[model samples]
Structures are given as C-alpha cells and as structure tokens.
Target: METHKSLSPDPNPAAEDDDHPAARRIHRLALHLNPPQGLHSHGDLRMLACAAKGKQLDVSTQELTEYMRGKHRDVQERVYEYFNSRPDLQTPIEISKDEHRELCMRQLLGLVREAGIRPFRYVAEDPFKYFAIAEAVGSVDMSLGIKMGVQYSLWGGSVINLGTKKHRDKYFEGIDNLEYPGCFAMTELHHGSNVQGLQTTATFDPLTDEFVIDTPNDGAIKWWIGNAAVHGKFATVFAKLLLPTHDIKGIADMGVHAFIVPIRDLKTHKTLPGIEINDCGHKVGLNGVDNGALRFRSVRIPRDNLLNRFGDVSRDGKYTSSLPSINKRFAATLGELVGGRVGLGYSSVGVLKIAVTIAIRYSLLRQQFGPPKQPEVSILDYQSHQHKLMPMLASTYAFHFATLHLVEKYSEMKKSHDEQLVGDVHALSAGLKAYVTSFTAKSLSICREACGGHGYAAVNRFGSLRNDHDIFQTFEGDNTVLLQQVAGDLLKQYQQKFQGGTFAVTWNYLRESMNAYLSQPNPVTSRWESEDHLRDPKFQLDAFRYRTSRLLQSAAMRLRKHSKTLGSFGAWNRCLNHLLTLAESHIESVILEKFIEAIKRYILVSALEGGSFAIHKLTEYLSFQVRNIARELVDAFDLPDHVTRAPIGMQSTVEAYSQYTQYAGF
Candidate 1:
C-alpha cells in the first residue's frame, strides 16, 4: 500500500510580493479557510484569486476540491503524479487511431512500472485500493484508463478468476509483465447480452486431444474486442463447448465455457493460422483501445487450455462440473467478469468529475446580466445556473461514495465462493454500473450545456469526456439490459424461495410499503407542504422505496398476466420499460442511502472528532439549509481546477487569462 502525499501550499504568508496576483489569491482564499471558527464558506480557492485581482467572480468557491478528495487525497494526488509524469497521455483530441492505441499502451505499462498500480495483481484483501488507482487513470484520459482496464481487468481477469494452477503459472507473470497482450473475447457480433445465443463453437476432438474452435458465421466473430487490432497475442475466448455425446460426458446442455486461446505470434505479432483479425475501425470514442473483430476458421488448442476453475474436461474427454446445473455454472463463470462492470462505474464517475469541474470553474469566471450599478454578476449568482449545475455536482459526490462502497463489497465477496454473495455482488454491480454510467452521460451533457459555447471547444475537454463516456452506457453491459437483470433479480426475491441480501432488502421495503398501504393509506406529502420532512433521511428513503415498490408490483402483475396470455419472452418484452423503471428506482434508493451514510461518517463524524464548537454548529446549520449549502455538498467532490485542464476552469480567471496571453504571445 504505497501512497503519495499531496503537496501542501506554502505556509509563509508574506513570502511573495503583496502586489502579486497569485500571492494575493492565496491570501484571500486563506481568509475563508480561517473564518471565525464556526463559519465555513464553500468558495472555490481559485475564485479567491479572481477576487484578489479585482475580477468579476461568476462562481462560488464553496465547492472546494479539499472536500471532494476528503479521505482519498493521497490516492488522488498519486493519480495527478501518474498523469503529470507521462505528458504523452494528456488529451487534446486524438487524430489517428493507431497513434492513440500505441500511446495508451505505453502509458498503461508505464503506470504499472513507475506508479506501482499493479493492474494485473490479484488483490482479494484490498480491492478498493486497486479500484481507486484505476479510477485516477480515467481522469487523465479515458482511453488510457479503458486500455488498462481491458488488459488487466478483463483479459487478465479471466485467467485469474477462471483458470487453474497451470493457467496461472503460465500466464499471470507474463500478463503482469506485459509479455502477453491479451483481449477478453466474450461479446460476439450477434450476441452481446444474450450469452446463450453465442454461435462460436469449441468442439472436442478426442483423437487430436485438442479443442477445435471456430466462428461458424460472420455474426459469431468476436467484435468490439479491445487490444485485438494490434497488441493482443492471446484471448480468453467464450464459446459453446460442443462435446461428443458418446465420450464420457456430463452437463445437461453443456453450454458456454471460457478457454485460453492464442491468436497471434508473440514476437512477430502476426495472426496465427486459421485466425483472421479485422480492425473495428474508428468508433464514436475509445479509439485508443484497438478494438477489433476476430474470425476463427478452425483454430485448435490443447484440452488443458480450458480454464477449469468451475468445470473441467478429463484427459479422456469426460466433461465434469461440480455445479450440476449448466445455468448455475454459467452464472458463476460470468460473475467473475463483474469486475469489468464495477471498473466501468468508477471510470464513468471519474470522467464526469472532469466535466462538472470544467463547467463549474467556467461558471465562476464568466459573467452576464446584472444590476446596472453593480459589476456584471457571475453566472453562478443566478438561480437557473445554480439549479442546473448544483444537483449534478451533488450527484457526482453521491456516485463517488457509492462506488467506494461497491469496491469494498466486491472485495468482501471475492474471498469466498458463497453463491448468495456472488449473486448480490453481480446484481449490485450491474445496477450501480447502469445508474452511474447513465448519470455520467446525462451529467456530462448538462455540464457541457452549463458552460455554453466554451464547453464545445476541444481544449475545454468536455468533447473528450462526453465522447468517451457516451459509449459507457453500452460498454460492459447495455445499461437497459443490465437494469432488466437487476429488476429480474428483484422480482425473483418476491418468491417464497427467496433469501436476503442488498437487493432483496428492496423487496422487503416494497412488501412493508404494500402492507402499510393496504392498512392505512394516506395522502402523499409534497415538498411544498412538508419541507421539514424533505430534510429527514427516513422520509427520503421511504419516498424512493415507495416508488420502487410501486413499480415492481405493477411490473410483476403485468408480466404475470402477459406470461399467461403470450410466451415468456413476450411477457418480458411487454414489461421491459416498467422493469427498467423498477431497477432504476431501486438503484437510486441505494445511492441515496450510501450518500447519507457518507455524510454522517465523513462530514458529521469528522466534525465531532475536531471537538470544535463552531464545526458542530456548522453541521447543525447545514442540516436545515440544504439549498443554501448546495455548494458545500458540491465541494465534497474535492476536484481541483488543475485536473479540469480548461483555462476557464482554473483557480482564477484573471490568472488563467494572463497565462493564456503569455502562451499566445499577445
């Protein structure tokens, strides 16, 4: 657990000339920091620079980076160091796909070597540490983050989770050392979510004692595979295992299983015989990942290549699995891949933080309409502007805290093979992944719009943030499809056989609500009528719970009726939208709970520890004035202006403009 320390601002107040803008800015920012013990202002330290230099301030400093980075300051600083050390990984806009891929590959490996971000290392004890490091990569450039994720989290992850001792011995060291560049070839051209529909086949040949793998049709070709176009030499291929009926056999359907298949020569980087790889070409985003489509004609690999963690094939071609049900085995296998989805959730928020940072920084500097007598006001003064950006800012904080919890839970689940824990982690990751990514897409757009024309500029970096994260909605698993899985799992919890976990609690909440509604239904209280209740945590949770329960009940009944009339698929299709709503509501409820918990732990508890009467008083003040304290909540994101990399997003607009003039030779 090596960690880096953040550089503290120089404590000597009088070191710089009083006339110097930077010095003056620091002095003014220090003013708010030391404000009479009890009072805290959520002002951006950067905006203080604007105030010192006699510039109009458009945004409030209340949304401070110190608050956002709170406990993770060390990790966040390390992230900054990693990116700053590798200037090549910084983003403007990538022009060539090949160049993007090469640069990302270099940085991915370099981060591992220099920063000790062991992307390939198995960290069953402290996955949150690994996840935080991975998250920091995204803030620099999403391509680099994604390329690293593909290499370690997906490709190498398959070998680690599914493979036995032989597979680990042969591949783990190589994968960690970058000796083997690999891709996870799971999603086919025709089948993305529908794993059962995959057409690629790995048939046993008893005489050859090898599995002959083939992509039977164009649709079966592995598509959108990262690291496949240029870097990958091997792949963890997921295919239907077609076994001879006469050969000693098990598994009722004998469905999909993972196998390690070498696709290219390590030295020459050339495609092996019977292997055809085609570039997927430029995508809307993530051009750096080298996504490609692979068609296997008759690629043959040894029987020992089967990643035999959950299932195995005997030397005599006997297929044996500890898990009797094919469906259960398939589920356990896919659960191993949930790491990718969890990584994506964290990555999406990392990018969104950048987008919101840029927008907020710019809003603080730019001015528009104001009273005739006064200097034109900062756009942040307007309710409309604050309304547009503040909630998103709050949501970002919420998502980050929620993601931290997800990483912790994921680590806990990995230590054991508890089926319930696995299912819980998988379902929770799927739901959170959908919620965070969908929020990322929408929030980026809102932040972009908040910045007006400047946000559209490539230099501001919203273009990169939006373009890269836009694909995240459909990345590991389509958000809509993933939500359906969550909803389907939730619906199952209503059955008599259902046990309890995080998602199952949503069912319990719903059942209690239904019972209460039947016993004593009352008119709903609106925020207008019950403003005090709006501040109550129980009220918020109950409201969200009611929405989810109502949706789940409606969807379940509709689905049941449809199933009786039509087929199962038709029933599901008809209730798809309702199911999606139910899933989304459930996820939002979880996020809200996680965020409130964070506030209690990080904010309230920390304040109490300080033993300052003022701090305690401030906490009490915040409890009743959420609207006035919105900036404080946003500040909890702890994102600094430097990371935003936009001129308008700097600590001081005047200083930012001065630097621009110097750079442009104006």
Candidate 2:
C-alpha cells in the first residue's frame, strides 16, 4: 500500500501518491514488506515489495462487506455456521446422481426442520434474509441452492402468494413443518416464458364441484420440474381454467389459474392416479435437484383447491375474476413469481463474486515467468491478467449495489397492490434478472480462463458454476424474452409520456432524450475529454444517460416504421436484436447510476455518523482513485474463507500457500 517509485518514468510520481488515501490506510495494515531478488532495478524491487504487502486492506474490506450485509449480518453468520457445522448438508465428493439427490433432499429436510417458522422457513417474511440464505448456499454448492429455492422460494412461495386463507391454512403449516413437499409446475415442454401458451387444461364440473386437470399432449407436460422425481407430494399446477360447455365463449376469455394438485402419495411417495412422472435423467449440473417431468390424464381436485387470489370458479360453473381482463389477470398472477426473479438476480451476482474471488486470489499466489534465475512474478502483476479480470471485478461491485436496490424496490412494491407498481416491479426485475445472469455467465467464463488449467478442475468450483448458472440465463425466464419484456415496457413508458405520464426511474431517459433533442446548440460531448473525467460522477451519468436515450429512441423509431409495413409481430421479430440492445443499454445505465447513488449515500451516511476513516477512504478510492480500486472492490464482496472453499482464496496469502503446498506435496 505504501507508494513506491515507478517502473516507468513519471514527471510527477508524487501526484499518484497524493490521490490515494486508501493506499495510505492499507499501508498501515501491512505487517512488513519484503522483496525477492535477482538483478531487478532497485525501484522495481521496492514496488514489488509494496505489491506483496498491499493485499491487506483488512478494515476497508470488512467495513464494505458489513455495509453490504447491513442489518442481516447476525442472521447470515448464524445460518452460515449452521450449514458449516453440518457436514451432511455440504456437497459430497464425486457422488452419483442418485446419491446426490438423496443426500440433497435429506439436507433440505434438515434445513426445513431447523428453520421451522423462522425467516428461512416456507414463505419467509424477510425477502433479503431469504435471499441471503440462497446466496450462502450458492457460494459453496449451487445444486443445493437450487434444491432449497425450489422448496421454499418457488413452491412454498406460490402457495403464500396465490392461495387464500383456507388454502394457506391447509398448506402453509405443513409446508413449513416439512409434513409435505412440493414443486411449482409452471413451465411446460413447449411453453416456458410464454406461460399463457401452456396447453394444460383444468375444466370445471358443477355437478361434482371439482376441477379436472389434464395435459392434452406431449408439449403440455410439465418439464424440468424440481422435486418432482422423488420427493414432492403436491404441485402448484398452472393451467387454463375452462368454464362448462354451456358457459364457454372463446379460448381468450378463459384464464390460466393455479391449483394445489396432489402429485405424490404421502406415505409411500408414489405418483397419484392419472399422473405420470419421469426423471429428467442427466443435466449439465444441479443434479441434486432431481429435475423431472410430469403428465396428467384426468386428475380431479376439489373446487376449493384453486388458488383464488386473482381468479375463481363459482359453484354454478361460472368464471369470475377480480382483474378486469385476461392480460391484467395474467400480469397479476405472474407477479407473484417476481420475488423468485429478484432473488435470482441477487444470487447471480453472488455467483460472480465467488468466481472472481477465486480467480483473483489464485492470480496472487500462482507464479509465472520472470527474469532468469530470479523469483517468478505473481500472475496478477501482468497487464494482460488485469485487463481480463479487473473490469469484471468492478462490475461485480456495481451489480452488488444494483441488485440490492432492486431488492429494496421490490420490498416496497410488495406493500401496495397498485397495478402500476406491480408492472413496474415486474419490468425492473425482469431486466435485472436477465442482465445479472448473463453478466455472471460471461464473468465466470473469463474467470475460469484466467485461472488457466486449475480452473477446469471441479475442485476449483468454476466448472460447476459455469454449467449450473448457464440454466439461469434461460429459466425463471429466458434472458432474451425478459429483455424484450423490458423493451415493451419502455415503449409503453414512451407512449405514456405523450399522455402526461411518467414512471419512477425509467422515464428519465425519455425526458432526457426529448430535452437533448430540442435543446439550443446541442450539449457538447467533450465533457468526458478530461483525464479525470472517468472519476467524475456527472460525466459517467451523462454518458450512460445519453447512450441509453439514443438506443431507446432509435429502437422505438425502428419498431414503428417496421410495424407499419410488416405488421406488429413480423416487425418485432425483424427488430429483435435492436430491441435487445436497447434493453441491455438501459439496464447497464441503471446499474452504473445505482452504483453512483449507493456510493454517494454511503459516503453521506458515513460522514454524518462519523464512521471509520478506513471506510471513508474506501469511498474516496471508489471515486478519486478509481483506477486502482479493483482489489479493494473485490475484497468488498466480503466472501469469507469458508464460503470460497478454494485453497487459493483462504484467509491470507500465507494460509493459501500453506494449504497449497501441503496438498501439492511440495
């Protein structure tokens, strides 16, 4: 951390020293500085000595991670310890798929029993705390994370959101107490993002006061359903609710509704009558989830089985819904699943953090070619290595704040049933889920390559991370489909502006575009020309805003022109790539803007509370010394040694080297 002489000539090297208060603070944390030798320039050796000692920014790292953890640190630590203490809950060593599934279920049931009626239980009261549990599980083994999410976040959460008091009374206690297991049967063999297109049907029978559910064809079968292979006793099945023949008008009028259908027998763990369930044999990863498929011939359920939150069936076979139209009702019903998207976004960022943490720490310990007969330099000292991993490190930090903001916004939206709020949250969550997952996918790939041969090892964790997280880009919602959803929302906001309307945060780009287009003597683009412009929040914000506005404005124009000639669907398909770009740019702008806001807020609060100088200096490094903030930002992810589980990412360089040498028999 101590400033040293430069290897390359500088007119005023002290200027670099003057700008970095973080280096000064981190310098004090360094116990000693020692340089390994052979014919290196005195100045170069001095710099190497500093670099060797420089990774220790103990206070800054802890403060930032503490800030990230916020009020949930105590609960997070307790949960981490609970999982750590239970070896059975941990991933096994090279087990077969059957063994993996069985062990995973046993571990899941243990967690359910342990977390009975608590925040980590079925339908958790605190969304952040619930996500924290997912994050911690994902850090060590994502297969376990997916299994846990299926049980609590997706299946149990559906009952909490879509079910009424009676439904809750019948299911919630059992779900919380592990008396029954479940799956969310939403995705069909042919229909994933297009939930309305699912061919599963649930027809009402007035005489029997029941609903007959059937999967009409192969395409309608529920597919890739977690917990369906072995454990689930019930499924929150989504299907088109049909009225009696006399009451039917057309297909569009009938709505998709959720029903609590029995899938497996409780005592024997067997499939119920008319239900055909099969295990999806092997996957790229996440084998612990027991992914499976299901088809129903003629399953019957009591009328009260319908999750009657948004739509319901009358005793006389009439169809009624609180939502006015099918589309609105679809939005309302699907809105219940937004929490899963939000949690996925947060969990994706955590995955990237884990990947980069392992890569960066390995770079610091793994040595490579240097001056002949001299000690080899750490790989991290190379510019090529830095270029590959540093920006991703910064992005990891940016995504951290962005996802947290999304979580907070989601929490606020949950309190109100306003249609506008629901739509807004849906659009935002969709955008973030797509952006963060894609980012993590690419980041893990880069991190894997960055670590060279070692990264390919299962022990290193990147291989599993890459394969398991690859599904994230497609499931929950397809990334491309979700991006298109965001673009459609943006177009809606664009049209709303003419009607004297605006949305919470997205509308800014529209307003900014209009003002920029109409301004006298257009604003200069040279505002970013200065050497320090990258460090200026205003310059960064303006650049992001302008790029987002230009792309969106152009996208809207293209859609309009093409639609007039090719028709709406044809034009949309033709311009799909542009629309995707528009959505991506807008999301990137949002993340950078949110990052600036978070840093500003932390700085303001720290100043007011008279917080630690180290934390204050960390903020200064984020802004003023932005060029050198890579290591600090990565450390801010606050991944504990236990969570990393990589020998190279242990507590200290010494600890990592100690374990590595022993393992290598050096």
TM-score of each: 0.83, 0.85
Off by over 4 Å in 1: 1-76, 122-125, 247-253, 497-514, 517-523, 526-529, 604-642, 659-665
- Cα lDDT of all candidates, in order? 0.73, 0.74
* lDDT for model 1: 0.73
Global Cα RMSD, each model: 14.1, 9.4
Q: Candidate 2 on 76-183: residue-level lDDT in tens?
A: 676577778887677754778998898887776766567432433524456877887778766757887887788777888888888888987788777766677889
Question: Stretches of candidate 2 above 4 Å error?
Answer: 1-59, 115-124, 247-253, 371-374, 509-514, 517-524, 604-632, 657-666
Q: Tell me which residue pairs clash in candidate 2.
A: none
